[model samples]
Target: MTESALLVCPHCNAVNRVPSARLDEGPKCGKCHQLLFDGQPVELTATSFQKHIDKSDIPVMVDFWAPWCGPCKMMAPQFAQAAAQLEPKVRLAKVNTDTEQTLGEKFGIRSIPTLVLFRQGREIARQPGAMNTAEIVRWALSKISR
Candidate 1:
């Protein structure tokens, strides 16, 4: 039997079981019927944060940012590029601190552009600042290897 991983749908918050070997083969959610991985960072809100973060068997990397921050704005495209490069192995997500203040407060986010890596519902590493696409990929890979 092929091993499978539980992945939460980015669009509808439905949990989907994807074969570990077929993660890159485009899995769809049973409940929502939406593509599970889009090779882009999923938008996270206060409502969807817990499920996606806690339920996923794969590592999740979140970018906590505020629209008003210049650094956050500048790094948006870089983050997106990093997401495309990191997907299937890692799930990249974004949480707008301006819209989700509660999440920001819960995470104790004092910076505009903060990246947090979570596995099995617990945070493993956090980087507080804007990073380029290459830097983001390097940082995420380095931390996950540990």
Candidate 2:
């Protein structure tokens, strides 16, 4: 039997079962018919956040940020670049702490631009502050491999 992984659609938040070996083959969502990995971080809300964390078989790298933060703004492009490199292996997402205050409180986010890595519905690692593309990718991969 082929190994399959569950991936939550970033666009529609629909769960999809995809063959593990074919992750880099550009899989599309069954329900929404959208490409699963678009080389971009998904914008997640409080309602959709838990589902992605709980359902994804791969590690989820969440950037908890606010619009007013300067470091957050600087890291946005770096995060997106990291998404392009890390997709299929990791689900990169962003949560606006300003809008999702409840989520921020739930996660006990003490600072802006916090990078939280979740696997199998549990947080495995977390980093506070901004990082460049190389730093983000390296940090995420290092954590996931542990």
The best candidate by TM-score is 2
Over 61-107, each residue of candidate 1 has an lDDT whose tens digit, in order, gives 99999889999999999999998898877899999998999999999
lDDT of 2 by residue, 1-146 (tens): 14999999999999999999999999999998999999999999989999999999999999999999999999999999999999988999999999999999999999999999999999999999999999999999899887
Candidate 2, overall lDDT? 0.95
Candidate 1 vs. true structure, TM-score? 0.95
The number of the candidate with the highest lDDT is: 2
Backbone collision count in every prediction? 0, 0
Error of 1 at 34 (Å): 2.2
Where does model 2 exceed 4 Å of error?
A: none
Candidate 2 TM-score, C-alpha based: 0.98
| List of clashing residue pairs for candidate 2 | none
Give the distance in Å from residue 19's predicted Cα in candidate 2 to where it truly belongs.
0.4
